[model samples]
Target: MIQSTDEGLMRLALREAAKGLGRTSPNPAVGAVLAKNGIILATGYHQKAGQPHAEIEVLKALSDYPSAKGSSLYVTLEPCSTYGRTPPCTLAIRDAGISRVIVGSIDPNPKHQGKGLAELRRDGIQVTTGVLDKECTRLNAGFNKWIISGRPWVIAKAAQSLDGRLTRPIGESSRLSNSHSIRMVHRLRATVDAILIGAETVRKDDPELTVRYGPTDHQPLRVVVTKTGMLPIDARVFVGEQDTIIYKDRSWSDVLDDLGRRSVTRLLVEGGGQILGQLFDNYLIDELWFFLTPRLVGGDKPTIGGVGVQELAGAPRLVDVRYLRLKDDLLIKGDLQWPKNPSRAF
Candidate 1:
């Protein structure tokens, strides 16, 4: 498909919208740009929930919206039509006399949905949908998942040695990936609502699980899954952050409900073998991000405590595998296609 120059600009606007990842809970991150005759005028993005929408921010930035009556507006998501905390974005577009609007994707909120686009048509405005749609949809995947499934989209992340081992010998907490990859993991932590690890992992690694990389507006909630509820009070995970949760044994459905109640739309699961086995056994994992390192630990060690499939044919398969080389480590990210179930958490 051929993309126009404006589409490229809209794509950039969408990227600008993603800056508010962990901060924008209960609201999708949106980016907008106002342009006239292929020249950009103003640009803005939704920073957090209850704040002004991207369109409002852009219009506020411009001194005179009436002067740019023939200008085009590019937004990552559909402008809202409802009276949220602020006024409807549809009304603002009409008042500004914007001749054209290019939307990256339709908003998933049932209250508005396509109503914003419909309002634009009523006002004799030219509107376009699906401009760089795939990328835009991906940018707000967490929001969509929460709206549709009522649960956070879980990503099970792990680093495996060349021989399929997850770690080094016992009592030795050596680093698996390089320093660059460690920073990348911190970046991933910044985007999610919470990070999960087994009690064993916390006791073994004593990881702080805080953002030590680039600038991030919000830090994810640190979570520990425990069976005995004997987590150390002085553990590194508990030293600084008070926003930590220690979850006990519960049904997979209830786990999903608990996360939903916490407004954790995006969850990253960093686990040891036993914890990974439990999630996989219940078919609760939504995505997988496994890193393959160059060093090989040629021993009896295994990557994860075998996710009890019972049969070889029933072993989980992660398709659409992609490999990105970070230094010598190969990061393989893929989506797991589990079968349909009563609860969409799987």
Candidate 2:
């Protein structure tokens, strides 16, 4: 029973929810709206973990508005039926006396799978789903991957010079790509669950790894994988309210378990080659997003690690490839398909 205007507003809410992307790690980006008599009462987007979710935020913004009892509630994801850091959103919807519920997507987590819909139906609310399936799923892909696969979707990112070098030379400060591409990197950061880097990249680049586009309301979890856990405690990435996790000499299964326990479902690996190599060697990479600049730096620096002769001899193969043109750069994306218990390719 979605009207044209209702669908348009739902799109707006989805975009609003996307704004919460880089910030609401360990929590899904969600948006909600309260509507009655074809009039919008309130709207909200989930801002961060431990804060009021989208539904709760919108209800609070309504603030005892007398006519909310018969309003319809529209949300980007199924209202969560379980209590975690906050109260169950299903309970909030029921308490509001909403006459109808429309959800963009369902929660893929087994614990809450279909439970939210069941709860709403049991409470005599009319519930409809799949209003904007594709956008909603895209927004919560990280959450779905973590819930269904026990590991976050891996996103490999890199910035190289015109000649495909990460840097001019070791320990040298040189620009690798243009400002537009760098801004796109920030946009990518604004949408992922977390940003990961190797200890060497942290020590050498000293990146802050915070989202620099739009608002600064929330930051993604900053993660570092180190063999010796040698990252400096005083690094700038540690100064923010963003949660940080360090994986040290742990098996891939152990790392996935830890991230699952912490509710991280999507992870971005931004590296200095060596870290990328290790992930590839372990057959842990799921997706690759490569930005190929038009210029070239014909230096001795490596492009991407784990692509050498020994590594490629038995490495995982690319199952899918897509091309995107961004100004002068070409974005090459691939899906990695690793064999069962594949040997260490590197």
Candidate 3:
């Protein structure tokens, strides 16, 4: 049973977990709170990959471990029971003399599922599960999806005019999003593990595709997919110091499989239409974010190219959709109900 105070503490833990979102790749952002008598002693969050997890950070923050012998620890996710880069957190919790362990969600990884809680119970520590479960689960939705599906969560993004045009009448590139929305796109780029674009976009937009609107210690990998290896050698994407990958004449599924093998948990596809169309045609995209500007650039170059579904029922539907006002543009975001692999439940 969880008290109201426990929910509040778990919410705080979730907030702490969010601080690591962009930096923690191949690992879920987890937060932990140590409390005694309903009062928080210390709070911590996972900072990056191959670093101390949330539970270890909370245990290390304690100035006097003996004084907080009966402290209760609240974590957004299950404490890891296996040794990887660091020792098992379950052992640390038991040695720390914590009396109760409340977890928001179980580890989605099949190997770690419920093992941490089971370990804690074996050591005589009181365990409570599923405190603020939905938020905790949603916080690491990309991680969970990757863990279960073995592929990165794909988010397709584009900036388009109200009339659904992606460029001018002559097929020249044009900026449709406002300055604020552009910064938002950059922020989105910073959060994902990689940014994917088509070669046509590279030739026309010539975007650097690096995070420029804000400060970031790491930049997402820039990936360009093309049938013909015809991009200019002097293109900014190739010239920049940041890492970039060129996939020539490869299947989209194969590209995704390779990305998954590289442990990319989140992938953002910013495109010039044909690529986005192929992804949509294959049901590879999981989420969508489109910035719609106030202006209408009437032309044959729409945001999406290719022969779309002939039947209305064949079209994919967006669920849990949201519209946000970004300066002069509207940011429409949602998840696609269709999955790349229909058998996989991501």
Could you say which candidate leads in lDDT? 3
Worst 10 residues of 2 by lDDT: 337-346
The alpha-carbon deviation from the true structure for residue 288 of candidate 2, after best TM-score superposition, in angstroms, is: 4.0
CA deviation > 4 Å runs, candidate 3: 169-174, 339-346
lDDT by residue (221-293, candidate 3, tens digit) is: 8999989999988888986677899999998778988888888888999988888888877767788999999
Model 3's alpha-carbon lDDT is 0.87
Candidate 1: where is the Cα deviation over 4 Å? 1-3, 63-67, 298-301, 308-321, 339-346
lDDT of the candidates, in the order given: 0.83, 0.78, 0.87
Query: RMSD in Å for candidate 2, one decimal?
Result: 4.3
Cα RMSD of all models vs. native, in order, equals 2.4, 4.3, 2.2
lDDT of 1 at 287: 81
Q: lDDT order of candidates, best first? A: 3, 1, 2
Mark the regions of model 2 whose C-alpha exceeds 4 Å error after superposition: 1-6, 162-164, 190-193, 212-214, 227-248, 299-302, 307-346
Cα TM-score per model = 0.91, 0.79, 0.93
True-structure Cα RMSD, model 1: 2.4
- Cα lDDT tens digits, model 1, 1-346, are 2237768788779877988777788788899999887888888888888999999888888877676588899999999988979999999999888999899989887887899999998999999889988889878888888888788888888888888777787788778888777777888888888888889888888988788898755788888988888888989898774488888876667776788788888889888888787788777787888888888876664666754766766566787777888999888887787655444343
